[model samples]
Target: MTDGEPIPEERGAPHRGAVWGAAAWSAGVLVLLVALPWAARHRLPDPLATHWGGHDPDGSMSPTGAALFPAGTWLVLVLATAALHRFGRRAATGRARGATGAALAAGGVLLTGAQASIVHANLDHARWQDADPVGTAVAAVVAASALAGLLTWLAARPRGATPAGPRPTPGAPVMAVPPGEQVVWLSRVVNPWLQLTAAVLGVCAMGGLLAPASGLIALNWSLVVPFASTSVIVLACSSVRARVTARGLHLGFGPFGWPARRWSPADLESARAEQRGPAQAGGWGYRINGLGTTVMLRRGTCLVVRNRRGAEFAVSLDDAERGAALLNSLIARSDRTAVTHGDDHR
Candidate 1:
């Protein structure tokens, strides 16, 4: 097996158990949200009214109470977010899972804070009716912080280390490690859940534009629109696959997107591992900053490929040394195979 060549497995469709898991969690969130108003209406009874100002004239809910509602919502969101992280970890690589969880948590906090601020401003100007804006904002912040912390914790869990139903057979070809030639497999680094969430948010933002009172909704749409677009772009790059072969190397981006780019062994320059500090690597994927090209998954090693034209291909692989060895083997095989064919023709 050459280094850049695709490792042969059973040639089955890639496992999508993670997607199913994410879907189940999404359904659970929907069910909970649908039931929340009814379940909490009588029992919780507007924390803002109970703790801050009191009930409104029509008993609808004070401003403070409305603000406090986000706390409860965040609690539910936190649980759902945790579940999403777990599902992502199972479906995606560790770095991707962590990045997705962090992005979701950060995005949620920003959105919640912005909404709370707007509500506070309205209350200050006496433009809106009902509760204590400050109290509500505080409650919302607390809830958002808790949820974010929970997501971070969940994302930090070990990868490919989960206890799935059963393990692969011990001597399976896919499981076997080549002698003296270590292999490094690079999976998609972007989280599908994150991409899906961004798309949903974008759609919601568009929907808000149609509403009569949608000033804030329109603002939200602006924020979410860019995020959705960026996520899609990142997902496209992460899905590209590159494999070393006896004759050459194969490169394809995304699962079903883009044609593969192949390069003959003779066109290759050199393959080596590059190391960088936290500031330079920018936490995984193909990062091209002022420090040059780097593919950082973990902290340590990145596979750097330079072609004859001096173009560089950097991929963040789990095992750097192993991947380097594999590439060397592939190059050697290509040379031998080319020589044998030439001799035979003569």
Candidate 2:
């Protein structure tokens, strides 16, 4: 098989154990979500307080509705993840399972927490309107959900996930490597406008929050929080670094590079450089369009790679031509090494 051809077993099919574990976790969480509130039906109001507006309850539902709503929502999320693992390219690549696990974990925790809070708030209350405030509970649950998601994403990452494919088409650019010499290409790109925008939004969000707390001015937390979130999201995609080496392509996002992507030589089908614009990529920041996922920051020339699944990832950077050429060369070199090793074993 050529390098670009995926192994028979790795053809976008999820591991059975992973599927079972995710299913089990989802079922257990769903049961707990429905059971906890039902178990305390006698203690809770006839129509439990389910939604809060600021410091007071503004929405309520029948005991059964309260118990089933969140459970049903959780069920839908579980099914979505199951479908991803069952039918998408993520099954074999295991690339998105971390995110899927994170969503599942976070959703389960959030829904369970919400249900628990509702039950606790409505306990011993004759009417749903008389239920206690759940503002603090909501805040705590959100924090817990975020923490759980992060932990799950980290834990669910596929281990020892080697690339599975034979070499792709031979037309990809090639760079001859000298014997006993190592070749590496590194490039970094940043959009100052995006960075400045993120900084401005972050500062505004902080000021808005602090002003209200300091008695300087009144600001809605909802607005400030969204601003802060937007700032963070924008900052994360404002800059990117790319490196091509023997290990293949390494891409780092944001300044600290906390979130990164890597592809080994054997995992790639092809690499090339092409001119791309934000319009083509559907605006700035990280974009997923018909052209595939593009990290478009003031796009001009982009280094694009097609992986074994035929998925393309493109990043705007300077000197992209050389980077693409180097990656293709590395892939070719890896293919040659594999052939040599096979002959030796024979």
Q: What would the per-residue lDDT of candidate 2 be over residues 143-204, giving only the tens digit for each residue?
A: 98899799767655543222332333344476666755675666767676776666567546
Q: Top lDDT: which candidate number?
A: 2
Per-residue lDDT tens digits for candidate 1, residues 1-346, read 3255544331222224235333443443333223323333332233223223423222234444454455456556656656665665455445555555454455454444444343333432322334333455556656765676465446333322111123334222123335555444333233344335543543343233222121222345565557556645544444334454444545555433345566666766666656655466665455786555654434555556667788876665434444444455555655666799999999
Q: Spell out the clash pairs found in candidate 2.
A: 2-166, 2-167, 3-165, 3-166, 3-167, 4-166, 4-167, 5-166
Q: For candidate 1, what is the lDDT? A: 0.45
User: How well does each candidate superpose onto the true structure, as a TM-score?
Assistant: 0.41, 0.49
Cα RMSD (Å) per model? Answer: 12.9, 16.7
Cα lDDT, all candidates = 0.45, 0.73
**lDDT over C-alpha atoms for residue 99 of model 1:** 56
